[model samples]
Target: MSKIKIVTDSIANLTDEEIKVYDVHIVNLNVLVDGVSYIDSDEKIAKETFYQVLKEAKELPKTSQPSIGTFLDVYDSFEDGTEIISIHVASSLSGTASAAQQAGDLSKNHVTVIDSEFADRGQAYQVIEAAKLAQAGASKEEILEKIKDVKEKTTLYISVFSLDNLVRGGRVSRAKGLLSNLLNVKVIFEFKDGVLTPMQKGRGSKSIQKFLDEQVYPKLETLTVKECSLSYVCLTEFLHEQIDKLKSMFQEQVLHIGFTVPTVCIHTGEGAFAMMYYHD
Candidate 1:
């Protein structure tokens, strides 16, 4: 019945208040613009300013996972022998998860490091569930079982209204990306086994939202929403507003609405929205 700690990186896209409420340990990721590097969720730079720099930059910003020293600091602060679970974004997409695992190995205490195989709310959602289970006196084995059960239920849906950002971010081929932009091919993307894969393509922003509402949500709704949370991590207020409306319709259930941070927004583009749900 002893307490177990939960740790995750900022790329999980969890908000400050949520982290505080869950008593979670958060490691910050670094976002470099031009030559200067800033922590992804630093309080010094408001999210709007961070996004402005990202939007207007002549060159795309570079991101780096938290250094081993940063992880060491977090690991050393907690009591020794405590069972710490550090979860992070997919290793395929970023080195954060791998770095965390390395840090865990160096930890003097017992650490359960997870690759998460997810990002944004998908990763954050698992941390939230694990924290709750740990708080309820669940053993580490029980908590990890819960994490694995929910991992499969965790889904990420990203809508990209502009391929320009993807091209700039090197996520797509310049020629094909530009052509897709010229063709007005708004992409509906989803994460499959930690890879960003396009699920559907449409002509405009409205069509993309329709795809989310009509096709995406319907399929996701079939899964149980027990203790599930929803999040809106995007570049535009309009996209947040749209998800807010969708969240309102499901008010009968308890769900946390998480905001996207610069860490996630940088890759997803300027007019993108992502919805994450967990059936755990």
Candidate 2:
């Protein structure tokens, strides 16, 4: 057994093999689509079904974080001597972090709760790394140090193709958002300081591509990114082009691509894609 155990929420977007190989534990978040609930597993069938149902639904899908009792249950399951690092999605985005912290306090084990301040693959970067270090017998201090280093080096950028969801989620004004959607306005955001700060907006998907071409590609060209992922609510022709372009940048590692979680889709709407990468 590893010296330390790893725990994270379903928002991390980890693969089944990644979880099995690294021995990471997950707490699920419930996503309700048209009154039917589905636990996020980052699986293809769930994503396909969810999105298809999403397209015809009259209301936006709702997502809820795991309860504090759930976290306490997982924490108490570990032996008293077991050290756990519980990493979760951004507190700014969900209450999962608070729940973990509350549970960590109540648990008898030594639990270190961390707010990853990211979603999907961004949070997975931290969870996976900590799991790796623990598996290799690294101390808690060393794992925490490495996690902090990676957090600082990480960058998450996103493009929203429609403003409808944001409007529905109350992130944007309904009238203005509806107008923007009708006009085909695309917005690009950089997730920084635990917030999705808008970087640029213009008409058409070209704006998204241009922003990436100018703002992100140069950085990728210079940095040694250990992980790269492109997560999306819906894939388009433009997304395929971006995927091909990003694949060209990585010499050895494969670019990780998957669906963005409901926490993000609530804000980005359909056809939104996020780019996340971190340097050493």
Candidate 3:
């Protein structure tokens, strides 16, 4: 039987337990702040500390995809004849997928690269599924087909309380950010076809919840939800409250919570929350 290995990037938002259980290999991205660089790993800089620093920083940090050399190093670490399935965040979101492809072309071992077309937990779902299938002694073709099916069924919804980070990162204009703050407007975005597009805007948290209830829940009812995960930049009473509500609502589905990665935080800022679900 041929050995299969699962590879993903830090943006997957996988937990330590999940990483250990699945034996997933992660390649870290470079986060530059105040002219200093840090790896996007818990060992290098904790997520809590990163958020605190981001809250105080004068300018938003810049993130760079892992180098092809980094990918090559990981690919070369495994023994010969090992088959690799390298899953990554959306190509439209980052160049990590392209870097993986470049390294795969240069690798000696058999390598298959996949663009998850999602980020955070949405991407993690595909990685975990592929890892599980590989661990079960499934063939490479079977695992790849499962991943492709999951990618097609995944849905990502994100809501941000503040647009400061987006404005600083140039994703949103300063004037619009200020206006949103003044009006207490919360904007929800949906990741579709590998692009993050604005879905709706509400006046406040209450209105946001109303939007979710009216728009999101109905759509979810139409699909056969298999798995769901929630991720947030910071933990708050509101977050806990929402989680409790979701847990009660989706009792049959697998539900989990995770902290957002630094790269995502750099764009959404604090008080950002996202819900990702996979369905058929």
By TM-score, who's the top model here?
2
Cα lDDT tens digits, model 2, 29-102, are 88776777767664532654455657777778888888899999999998888999999999888899999999
Q: What lDDT score goes with residue 102 in model 3?
A: 97
Q: What lDDT does model 2 reach?
A: 0.85
Which 10-residue window of candidate 1 scores lowest in summed lDDT?
226-235
For lDDT, the strongest prediction is 3
Error of 3 at 51 (Å): 2.0
Model 1 accuracy (lDDT, Cα): 0.75
Q: Between prediction 2 and prediction 3, which has the larger lDDT?
A: 3
Across 1-280, the per-residue lDDT of candidate 1 in tens digits comes to 4569999998777767778878888998988777788898776545655656667777877888898878877987888778888888888778887777788888887788898888777888788889888778889999899889878877777777777767777777799688888888888888857787888886877677777678866866676665444444333666666657667656644565545677666776666667667664
Candidate 3: global Cα-lDDT? Answer: 0.87
lDDT of each: 0.75, 0.85, 0.87
lDDT of 3 by residue, 65-110 (tens): 9999999999989998899999998888789999999999999888
Residue 5 in candidate 2 has what lDDT? 95
155: Cα error in model 3, Å: 0.8
